[model samples]
Target: MATVCISGALVDKLRACAEAGFDGVEVFEPDLVSAPESPEEIRALAARLGLTLDLYQPMRDVEGVDDAEFARVLRRAEAKFRLMRRLGVDVVLCCSNVATATIDDDEVSARQLRALGDLAAEHGIRIAFEALAWGRYIDDYRRAWRVVELAAHPAVGVCLDSFHILSRGHDPAGIREIPGERIFFVQLADAPRMELDVLSWSRHHRLFPGEGSFDLVGFVGHVLHAGYAGPLSLEVFNDTFRQTDPARTAAQARRSLRHLEDAVARADPSLTGLEMLPDSAAPSGFDFVEIIAEDTSTIEHLLARAGFTSRGRHRTKPVTLWSAGRARVVLNEQHARGRTPYLAAIGFEVDDASAMSRRVAALRTPRAYRRTYDAEEELEAAVAPGGTEVFWAQAADEGEPAWVSEFEHGGPRIASPVTGIDHVSLTEPWQVIDESALFYTATFGLRTVSATDVPGPQGLVQSRVLAGPDEVVRLPLNVAPPILAERGGPAALSAHVAFSCADVRALARAAHLRGLDILPIPANYYEDLAARVDLDDDVLAELRELNLVYDRTDAGEYLHVYTATIGNVFFEFVERRGDYAGFGAGNAPVRLNAQSASSAARESGGFGRVRA
Candidate 1:
């Protein structure tokens, strides 16, 4: 772990790393300088805590400068080297000159590095030269390696940072050209591809491995193939991590490395020595989704209107299970006396629950607290970064699920068109959107889809989707715009579970007849839909009457309906014709506007103030 990646005092950061199972940490220079403890005291504390002071960083702008500037660089280098000795760290990161480089020649930079290396050699310190992505020159790892080669100093070797190399679109395959022994240290960070200056991006948006768009497995493969056998240290500089809990962030960092290691091993079986975690496989489908609320009557009524029948109530807890065909919803009132109804847990049907649970443990995800009676099913669950509990249920070969027996039958089952969960849209706390994506990706092997930004009534909401293999399961994770999040977050807007059916029009009509309090679609929406797509006049009229939203593509067509918000949760019913795999994103703006309007109407005694 890198000290800069975690937020807290230096001592607290060290403790967090140790608690999170990191073998060592890269000490950022500012963190060290701001510490009240002497360097020797910090070293002693690290020893007591079982953490290696792996690398002291970073000596910057030390190369590509004039002789007078080089002399000052060497002088500064000697002082940091002495500090490293006192810190009990051998390797010091020397970043390529980004600001003070008056000379662009590699040989001049090499000569200066060699001189700095000579000064470091006296203090028994190694110089790990790294390229800053925005360096004035020597901005590429390949160029940094060339300079290291030219330096030809025993104490000098190149440092490879994933961000510096990958962010510039430099091919990592070139790493194999540099001998592994010359690669003194390795710093790993992943980042979403963004159009911004590399310096600002590096300082603000870097993520842990598996959390971003980079192909880190291939990147690390090239490094290991070159025989680099150093600690795979994390070096992220994310704005979120800098303010979040250090212990939690450190745990997340360690899990990211573990996940990356597992991915690399799986990608290349020939790397026999690399450790692997329990393999994560895509879940078959959603088993059930649990909602906790103080007033279960409102949710129960909504479910009934949507064609769901009460399957049973838990024998040992205040929980009820409702079903419509294969779709199941759990309502729990226990420990939720005063809270608004919200999604609490999701159960997935998997081929092997035990193996999935093991993978969750291996990934270091915190287990959710479940209060179970002695004879009830042992439903193992992991808490997501967004605080949703994820439970895995093994598919039974024949007969009902074993856990279903815990709920006594309430009445005869009711037949309905809703087949199963189509998808669940989660509103994430702004800070943990990236973390939530990584958690799902690493835990269930879900792959990320292209993210979309939907304009909401409050602002533009960023939506990222993750899907199971073959799209058997889909999760649309959304982050509210900053203004709305500042007010209360996307949770204040709503999270919803979407149900799939053969015909959404029929379902919506049925729901309306049953008085489901369907969300009202403005007549303007139908007019706009008519302009966007060629639909039969009668069908368009039906959609407007039933408050149904429609979206179409060359491949297929989609229709879906929504229920008015019940507390913080809502329900959506959808139908897919042909291969329409989208979530009706084109219709989201209308839906958001209607929801906002409906919320305003409810708060203002049904006479909502008009929105322009």
Candidate 2:
């Protein structure tokens, strides 16, 4: 097991951090740093709260300059060390000097590092030498570690950062070999892989752990195996999390932890899953279920032919349904908004939606309000995309109970009607076609469902699907061609269709060899993409060349897949990159062809493959 840290700001933001399974806090420095209380008082608060001080960060620019600057830096280190001593804070995070360094020569820089280490040793503190992304002397850990080893002071250690580690596209094996005792701390943060400068991103937009595109679990495993038993703390400097409520921020923290823990369990059996956290991996959780049609008449005729009966109006959007006991189908119109659901969001049953809503609101995270049918009349349960809904009549409305009662009654099968869709992967691009795919796979545990080549005006793109949480959701991994160059792109693929794959690249290769009109994504996307992805240049190039999309999750698994269309069946071809298991939600279509011949055939009562 690895040590976990609860950031000090998260204490007030998510009072539940410790209760949620965190072992320590980074102290965030500023919490105690600028507080009115004495340093010893903060230590008392930590002891009373059962929280350990994971780290005190950012002794900026300590190395550099002549005798005069050196003296001032030493005095500063001394003051910080005294604060550490008073609070029993054992670890000090000393990032390599980034800005305003007076030294330029290599020899002088080395001398400065040795001096810092010596000062830490005198103050009885262990210094975690981390190279800021823009450090003047030490930038890469491998390069900086040379000075750390040279300092020869046992107090100097390393702080392995997923961002810094991945930003440079370096392998993690070095971390795996470092003595745990010598590795003073591990910093955890994830971000959507971007092409932004390191400093701007770090101070402005780092994401919470498991929320971005980094391979979190594998990163963690590498650290754990390194024998470094330091606290794993989140150092996200996200604008979004800060804008949201503090309580919900805490819940986000908890969920982020659970998502990562569960991802770890799925990716590697050795890692433990969180017990207290609610997960999308919960048994029977439905990702999504689909009933497709080119037009409304087609759907009505199809369901009518199947002898299915229609349920009443949907509480939200334009979703109609046909049902048989324990077996139900939902009909979504083609005209629905956005890429896919201009029609409906999602609905679920809970014993107490209001209570759950209150609990969620108590956390103060953003939430959507919804109304539902109650025991006597209309009742309201605040609803959004995920759980947090209560419907007393959901059992009867859906033709069965929402949850299978294991209370002496839970048995053989509690019908959810049709098993739910794993997840719906809707692939659209803000120019970056892969961003959507990365978001779902990395933040959630969705795996690559499929990847298939499609003809486009611009060329071919082999989009893939990823599925995870092992639920009933269908992610329709879709893809469109690049805006420039090539022939017209292929059209008439469905708005979305979830995919699953045993092998993602092979699937892409299969589609490519199959002559299934493939689209070409730029080769440079891989090189640029490599900055965020942990894979080697070759692997990144191959995935991009195949037009396949992939994202790393907190578990260090690469969820990838290919897109496919089997006649009017419209299915996704999936491949799991590494251990990833998410449906590509980023791949969706602007238009779908339900078989051109079939639409005409249906009008004439000719033979047409019927869909229900």
Candidate 3:
């Protein structure tokens, strides 16, 4: 935590950090200077909250200067040391001077650092020297380490920061060369790959570990391999995080630490001696997806047309379960606010549901409880950052299935066509994308793939996919374009679930027979597909008849079709042959255009019912 940092009062920041389960905090100097509390009072507050004052940071522009300037910096350092004495902190961070540096020689800088270390030793404190990426002369960690080595003082050592090392394209493999005992502290931060000045990028664009493209797992692994066992502290500086609520930001920071620990542990099993929480059980597959709507008629009709049958009704609530093949959809109408339908919950089939609950609790994520009657199967759930509930349940076995007892199956069991969920699309505003990505990766142990930009009717939408290591479950997250009220565009594209089948043509034929309103595709798409890929004439004709869009890569071919938007949600059916691993991103623009047109037609007329 950066002090005088993040959005909140000083006391509130400390309290939020403690409540969010951080073991200790690095007190930023600016925050402390502005606070009304004396050093003694703040120390007492931290003590009362069972928090450790780990570091007092940062004493800057104290090295690589003229003699007179060095003398002035020495006096300033003494004053801060006295303050740290009162605060019961033994260590202070000294960042490389980015300004006020006249000397360029490493020997001069080391001599100055040694003089400061001598002062720190007299005060019973140590200095952790750090290298900022934008420092005047010493911009690299290796350079900072060289000065620390030349200083040759007991109280002087190097502080390793991930951002400074990684943002400069410095290889972390060199970290292992530094003696473990000389590495005094470690700071971690992640950022997306951006083409900008280092100072501006570091100040505003940093994100939490899994939210960004940095390889923090490998970074931390190198640090651990070097035998530095200090607290893994987070020092993020982002415009969005600073403006958000302090408590929420603190919780997210803590989760990132836990995630980093788990990832490092998995990367290096040889580091078994290091303390870390056990990784969450890997997800087997999706169990069920629940939708909440005031009137389930439209959703039910769409599901029926997609070849799903009403398999069961919740024994205790006003919910119905629709099944197709092994896939299940729960229509939860018991507590709906309006006619607009939205995804309410996602259930995962795991090896141990209870273990997942415990893992989530350890990360300080809040649990959500739903009212249940006697003899009902209780599923453990955690609330995601986007207000979606994630339920965990064990995979069903031959002996007994939990769903059989939870729902009353009275309708005929129709032979289902769809196999399972290929992917689930989640939409969020651009600013919330990083937060949502961190939530899923930390809570569920999912790994993120590279982000791709899809051209939409409104604008270019950024999309990233998160999936398990084995690719059993996939979640494609989209950052929606800004709403264009003048152009009459919706705020976001509606969320949808895509079901996979072995033969999409057969499923489309069944859907057509059931009178489903297939989203109309323009003939231009077929001509484009024909020029792009060589497809059999019969398959092309069948796809044209079913209004399906096509995309083929070197790996495999993708065929998919979308349903008309019903309320705030929609559905898609997809078929993948060979090794097609994409979500037909090439066809996003056409789908968005068609959906927008349909929405306009529906609004021009009254919101009349559309039957399947």
Candidate 4:
């Protein structure tokens, strides 16, 4: 568990780790030193919390020194070993000396470590020697292991840290070569790919597993394959996590461990014998999207223009279900807030909702509950990292779903080409972008497809997509950088829903005839498109006439159209042909430019009238 060395008061960290379901903890020496409690008191607290004191960590700068300094370091090691005896910890993590280590001889280092190991053995404690990435004499795990081998002490063993090894670009496969009994401890951390120095990068930019770019599954698999049967602990030093709420950070950290374990178990069949979480449920498609607004008339009008008809009205609340083919939109006016027409909830169709809920519960995420009416369906729900509500429900077993009985459906039908949800786009703050990505990936078993930078009116928007294996449920997360308040608020680069259709041109024509406020496209876009793709003149003319944008990749072609902003939300219509897999991201700059112009025109009272 991360409680061993993470930030926060020692007691709070232990309580949080216990509550997060960690069986053991590594105790950082500083946390112990700064605590008001004595070693005996800390040990009792760990006992009460039902946590084992696995290891006391990070006795730094201990080896590769001269005779006099070595003598002094042994005295310090003796004191720590006595403390560990009282603390009920069996092992201490000795980091390679980064300072005051003049001797570069492995035999000298080994001789010094042997003496320390002798002292630890007397105190009934062990030493797990680790290599610091910035160590003066030894910075590689393999080099540290060689020194440990030379020491040949029963009380001394090598500690392998993923960050120290991977951050230095060292191959972890060599870990399999070491004898399993010699590998005493293991520490895990993931970091983004950066060009900065290792010290600063490890301290400030470390992220939880699946949140960073590191390939930790392979790293852990190698360690397990070597028959290392110890607690897989976390030793992250992230600046942001240290400053955030400790309880929330602990919960996220625990979830990351489960995610990593599941990945490793999948990669190595031999390791599947170990206890692991259930496999992620496969998502079929989106069930419905819900929006919350103060007033529903504007959203209703927009839905009408897009050829969606009111299928049912909630029996007990001011909510309505709008549908077109397999696409469903629930306009919920029960709760209103600062942003009008904000996306409130998303529902997914999974193979088994109950199994998915069980897996999510084991990760320590909170479950969401709501008041249910007499005939309403009670689907399992959970709160996501960004406070968005996620509902899981399986397809109906027979007839209509149980939830539909709560709504009354009797209205004139509107027919159009829109079929189902193509994708749902969500906006996240810069700080929580990575957290949100990890949440969806871990919860729904989604894979991040690609990330791109989009030029917005305010600044560059970082966009990434999380999609299922079959491309059924796609969520595009957009993060807008902080902009000065004077820049007319950050651009609305997110908060839009796209609907799939058989033919985008036909849907655009239908929406235009229904008086939808279509976003105007510049004629230059068509001219550029003509130069880019080889298409018939008639097709190009039709695209320009309906204000549609076109893009084609080596795999396939895409066509899409956008609607003017309605309150804080907008809509999109898309068509894919020949296995087109992207969101037509190449057309984002033009769309953003046009939307900015439209907003400016609206502010000046010069834009065309929008029907309400």
Candidate 5:
């Protein structure tokens, strides 16, 4: 890991890295300078923590200069080399001259690098020459390698960085051309594709390996194929990561590397030095969704009005089961005394529960603890980055989960139109939204479909959706606008589980008759919809009367309705027609506005409880 990837006192960051199971760390120069400990003391701390001080970086603007400037660069290089000796590090990162290069000739740069390498050799240090993506002249790795070859010094080599190479769209297949010994160090970082200058993007937006859009597995494969055996260190400069807890961030960093290594090993069996993890396949479908609340009456009433029947209580726990068609909800009150109602956990039906459990354990994901009786099935679960528990289960011979037997059926089933879980939407904390995206993708093999901005009352909410194979499991993870998040309270949190059905119009009419507390949509919204959507007069009137939202695409149409927010959780019913795959994102703004208005009215005590 890179020192700049986390925030804390330099010593504390080192401890975090060690605790996260990193064997070594790249000591970014600024962190070392700002640290209070002497270089020798820091070295002692790393020794005690079982951490190797891998590389002391970065000796910047060291090449591509005149003789006089070259002499000055050598003096600075000698100083850092002395510091590295005290820090017990042997490799120094020398970035291509960005600000002080007066000449563009590689020969001059090569000569200067050889001179620097001579100085480094005296101090028993190796100079790892790297190309800066925005360097003045030697900005590409291939050009930097040419210079390293021209230098012809035993102490000088090329350092390959994923961001510098991949961000510039350079083909990594060229990596195999460089001999293994000439490649001294490898620094890896992934980044979201953004429209920005290279310098600003590198400094602010770099994400972990699986969190971004880079083809890191292929990149690492090329490096490994070249026989480069070294620590795969991280060098991220993300704004959010720099402010979070160092320990948590370090653990997250370690997980990313493991995930990437697993990917590389799986993609090509020939790759060495990669640990192969247990195989993970997409979940078959959602088994059940669990909600926890201190006062369950509100949700109980709402679910009843929406046509959910009380299946039964848990045989030996403070939990109850409710179902409508294929949709099942586990209402947990075991640990809900001080908590508001919230979407707590989701259970997925998988082909192999044991393999999935082992895979997650290998990834170092935090386990979610649950108590089960000796006679009950022991379901394995992990906590998501957004604090949602994820459980995996297999179906019994009767085509229902074995755990269903724990809940006794108290009454005859009431047939309802709700089919199954369409999708589950969770509002993530701003810092962990990207982390959550990575977790779902890497841990469960979910594919990110789209990322969009839905305008809310305060600002735009960033929404990214991840879907399983055949689109069976869809998750819309949302990050609220900064202003709304800053106003931290239960009112700011929003999450919902959407159920699918064949006929939303009929369900909405039946729900209205059953006295569902539907969110009120503005009449103007329907009027505007009429101007755009090709809805007939009767359909449009029905939508307006039932407080439903609609969206259309070239292939199909979507109809959905939302229940009023009960604490931080709510319910949504959706109907998809003719292969529609979206979550009706176009109607998010209307829903946000109506929900905000409802929340405000209730806070002022002007809105009575809209209940059956």
Candidate 6:
């Protein structure tokens, strides 16, 4: 829900929200209307505190009333609409009448709602008819939708509440059928199911999102599935939450958001690949690109085969290539770059060479080596190798080889696509996921963004990674190196995959259309998934077809996936779109099956598809 409003009574609620990293907050009417607080004062405070006034809510009883009162409420709605336009807010909360004389007359309510919605739309705002669980006429979303359908005003929409929806234990099968445009508001609140009357629970004693028993996540997923992309407010009737320190409350609110985020990700079964994306927090591209190549000559041969020409010669490290587009590749000749390379690093663009060096050093780990510029160039190098470790930084400002005389004198240049090392894969020997997580956290200040662990015949190794700023560069660290070879030789041919994707869905579609044959585990994956992440079939299937997987652990969020290609040297097409912090873990089993089948084909010299 985009327009989630917190009642103004929770004005202190802003404190709770800020602590929790909320992007905006909605202003409930009671806190503003009931109080002596002026709209000017409320607006000013929100601006001063960096909160968007998501909405002015609770314009109740506009529908199912006689002409006189209906006209009066219409005027009141106009005034609020004025305030909203001035405040740059676009939504209004209109709850169904509870205390008024309106009986369950859908026809009458529908007529009145249409008239009022037209009035509100003039002021550039929409009305959200909330089906109060205890309302005299409208209570359930299905009922509200029927009324809205007849009302049929573009600005007239529904407010889906987690409390109202889940409190009754309604199934989502019917709700998912609603179109996206009709969903104007979403309210999520949690509470222990008290023995008291439903009305009393709605009025007081509502718990925060994660603190309650109701499946708010699932409910939100349902609403999302219905195509309602609007404001989502946390409207809680909990007295305890209000009484606590506002910041703590807000932090809890943020935690609730993260909690719900993970819940939605895990709850959606359509997932396939788990990839941590790059972030803008760090100025560079990638900390390092892992290249696991055994025979040093093979490392050399592989580079030659890939059209990667050396930048004169390798220094500090062996068989490294300094390329165009501000990129560099380190061939760890220890193991012929596994069908999946180890430590394929991306070079980061840096403005302050010294400051970046200090920042990298601050992240403690196997101390990185600082490479001094040789006789040819001025840029120095530093290498940090743990998953989150800041393995290397090539100063684009003063240290690149292009600035040196050789390239300048020869009028030379590198190839197109201007190489920028996008990602790297690291392996941890410890079988424990937490231990691997600790490696990234300690070395690179990397936190576990997302993860997953599935029960397979071969078991699973939970994965984690430090998603650097905006999650633009992902350095993934694996827990329990998949047992590729028993003798600690390179982790196996099915070892790992490094991918690049212009569009992840296109990659999946490419595979599928080419008869790569994706697996179908369950049809229900979509039933509840869209409700969680708000992704469409194209994106979801692509993620699934890619075999991305994810999971939730007490330690943190995790998700990932391996591809369908052969054991070695395949790619994972990744595009860091948003806060998806993990790879697609939901697609693991599908990936395993396809991979095993592909491997079999190579041995038998014949490839076949999974029969429907």
Superposed on all Cα atoms, the candidates' RMSDs to the truth, in angstroms, are: 2.1, 13.3, 2.8, 2.8, 1.7, 18.2
In candidate 3, position 162 carries an lDDT of 92
Q: Model 1, 1-612: lDDT tens per residue?
A: 889998999999999999999999999999999999999999999999999998988888999888888888877887788788889999999999889999989999898889888889999989999999899988899999989999999999999999999999999999999899999999999999899988899999999998888889999999999999988899999999999999999999999999999989989998867888876579988888999998788999989888898978899888999988778899999989799889989988889888898898888899987878789888888999999999988977776578888888777876688988999999988889988998999899898986999998778889999999889899999988888877763333588999999888778777777778888889999898899888999999888777788988888988898888878899999999999889889889888888888877787789322111
Instruction: Say which prediction, candidate 1 or candidate 3, comes out ahead on lDDT.
Output: 1
lDDT for model 5: 0.89
TM-score of 1: 0.97
Task: State, as a TM-score between 0 and 1, how close model 2 is to the true structure.
Answer: 0.55
Q: What 10-residue stretch in candidate 1 is worst by lDDT? A: 603-612
For 201-311, candidate 5 gives per-residue lDDT tens digits of 999999999999899999999999998988789999999999999998998999899989999999999876678878878888899999999878889888888888898
How accurate locally is residue 236 in candidate 1, as Cα lDDT from 0 to 100?
A: 98
Instruction: Show the lowest summed lDDT stretch of 10 residues, model 3.
Output: 484-493
Q: Give TM per candidate.
A: 0.97, 0.55, 0.93, 0.92, 0.97, 0.44
Off by over 4 Å in 5: 489-492, 605-612
Candidate 3: regions farther than 4 A off = 269-273, 398-400, 484-491, 536-538, 606-612
For model 3, what is the alpha-carbon lDDT of residue 469?
84
**Overall lDDT per candidate, in order of appearance:** 0.88, 0.52, 0.84, 0.85, 0.89, 0.55
**What would the TM-score be for candidate 5 when compared with the true structure?**
0.97
TM-score-wise, the better of 2 and 6 is 2
Give the higher-TM-score candidate: 2 or 3.
3
Ranking by lDDT: 5, 1, 4, 3, 6, 2
Better of 3 and 4 by TM-score: 3
Regions more than 4 Å wrong, model 4: 4-7, 337-339, 397-402, 484-490, 522-541, 609-612
